[model samples]
Target: MELENVIDAAVEEVLGLAQGWLGWDGRPVVFDGNAWTPHKSLRRVTDHLVDHLAEIMCRLNGLDPLPDHWHGRTVTTHADFARFTETDLEEATSRLTRLALMYRAGLRGLDPAVLDARPDPDTWTLREVVEHVAGVVYYARAMS
Candidate 1:
């Protein structure tokens, strides 16, 4: 399958599961030795997509990627503890869907050679990066 198709499918699945959290109680669920709430899962998935997107863009432009200081799955803010409502679900759907589409557009714009070329020996190729983002299904899957 194409990388973009895989990413789109993963994001769609995440959002579908997130829709199930519309009336979630204000309790954190433990998963893989970490706590996960609806907000936290959404935030993490969004952040992961954005972070790697930035990295891909910067590498394509021959620039150093900015450091990401995201707290990730470790810190759950007060807002993360909020009740998951229909409004939040709508916002997540909008934000994540757009981001996933952006990834598709960006990947489509790149040359196939560039997709396979690593920015550095230690860095992942753009294709690998997209696959990594697709793996973020685990976040939403855990919450579901």
Candidate 2:
């Protein structure tokens, strides 16, 4: 399957689970050794997409990707404790769907050869990055 389709499918899975958060009871669920709330799961998924999207754009532009300082799965902020409202669900759907579309368009526009090019020895190829982002579906699934 095309990498963009794979990413969109994964994001769609998350979006489906996010709707369930509107009924969340504000209890913390532990998954993969980290505490998860509905908000935290959504935040992590969004952040992961944005972070890697930036990395892909930066590398394509010949600029270094900025470092991400997200504590990711290690600590939950006060905002993460907020109630998951219908408005929040709408916002998540809007935000994540737009990001998914951006990823799809951006990745589809790249030449197939570009997917195999690495920006640095330590960095992953663009193809691998998309796969990693697809793996983030686990975060939303954990909330389910």
Best by TM-score: 1
Scored against the true structure, residue 28 in model 1 reaches a CA lDDT of: 88
Clashes of 2: 0
How many clashing residue pairs are found in candidate 1?
0
1-144: candidate 2 lDDT, tens digit per residue: 878788789888998888878878888898888889988999999999999999888888888889988888788888998999999988998998899998988887788789998767988999999899998788898787
* Global CA lDDT computed for model 1: 0.87
Q: What TM-score does each of the candidates earn?
A: 0.95, 0.94
Off by over 4 Å in 2: none
lDDT (tens digit, per residue) of candidate 1 on 1-144:
887677789899999999888878878899988889999999999999999989987887889999889888888788888988899999998998899888888888567898898766988888988998898889998787
lDDT of each: 0.87, 0.87
Question: What C-alpha lDDT, on a 0 to 100 scale, does residue 22 get in candidate 2?
Answer: 84
For each predicted model, how many residue pairs clash, with residues at least 3 apart or on different chains? 0, 0
